[model samples]
Target: MGRTRTFDVNEALEAALGVFWRKGYEGASYADLVVATGVERPALYSAFGNKETLFLRALERYASNYANYVPAAIERSTARDVAEGVLFGAVELSTRFSDRTGCLGVNGALAGSDEAEQARAALIAWRADGEAALRRRFERARSEGDLPANSDCATLAAYVLAVAHGIAVQAKAGFAVDTLMAVARQALEGWPRSGNTLVAEQRL
Candidate 1:
């Protein structure tokens, strides 16, 4: 009979995520994963297939945790509140990490090679879908008269996402949290305002 494995898969994945998060996809070696996850090579391969597969799994786990912020903010706050919260929250999270790893997806986009192109594509698609959902939320806000009829949801969503990406990059570059917050504030200066009507947008 095969020896029983004793490691927690979720915990191992989380550890792997931290390694990948700090060092990025290409930078993270199998040795790093082994050290971080406390799993032997054979156990790691048996659980996660290979390095690329393990990295993809870590990416998925990271995305699952990070992608919910915007939707949750939108769901729990007013349109303006949601906009501010999501942008600032991103900056906060990015700066909180020790290496200031920015965003896993954004880092992956820049760091990935042809071998990891599929992972990069999936990350980009996920980001695009997130932006689309935010756009829809803005459209709903406009339709309900919580924003100006002339407000362009698509452009606004793109602008917000751009700001987020910029913040992520800047954070990775060792930018101060105050500077990122200033950037967020500047981005929000363009938000549409309406009379005192608010609704909690649904979570994604």
Candidate 2:
């Protein structure tokens, strides 16, 4: 019979996620993972396969936990609301935590090499999924007259996602939540006015 695992999987994964978020894929070594997770090397291998696999799993865990605000924000009243919630929510999410500030997805995008290509690919796919969802939401908003007929939903989606990415990058660079929110507010000011009413009328 196989030996039973000892540590709490979710708890350990959360720890691993923090390490990956702080260090990135290539920067996070096996020693780092083992120390952060409080698991022995052999046990870590048995539970998560390899460093790359562990990083992927940790990245998924981070996404499931912290990266969910985007989807929730997109479900708000208007396309402008979606953008506002997304940007402001990004500020809160990126800076709310002290140790793990910034976005794991954005942080992971830059680090890693050929060996970590799968992890990189996973981050890319995740971003693409977010952009796709945003596009669909904006397209629906345009159809509902929440946005002007000439508004490009794809560009709008890309623009918001890009801004969110910028927020993440800025957060990683030690910007405070208020500073990031200031940036968000400025971005919202540029939100397209539909029906001569600013979409960012609602306060953050």
* Native-to-model Cα distance after best TM-score fit, residue 94 in candidate 1, in Å: 0.3
* Per-residue C-alpha lDDT of model 1 across residues 51-136, encoded as one tens digit per residue: 88988898778767865687787784456777887898788778877753588767766756787777677777888888898888
Candidate 2 clashing pairs, residues 3+ apart or interchain: none
- Model 1: how far is 156 from its true place, Å? 0.9
TM-score per candidate, chains pooled: 0.88, 0.93
Off by over 4 Å in 1: 195-204
Clashing pairs in 1: none
- Kindly list the per-residue Cα lDDT of model 2 for residues 1-204, writing each as its tens digit: 999999988888889999888878888889998899899999989988998888888877777788888888988988888999899888988888888888888887575668888888988998999999999999998888788889999999999989999999999899878889999999888777677345446544
Q: What local lDDT does model 2 show for residue 63?
A: 71
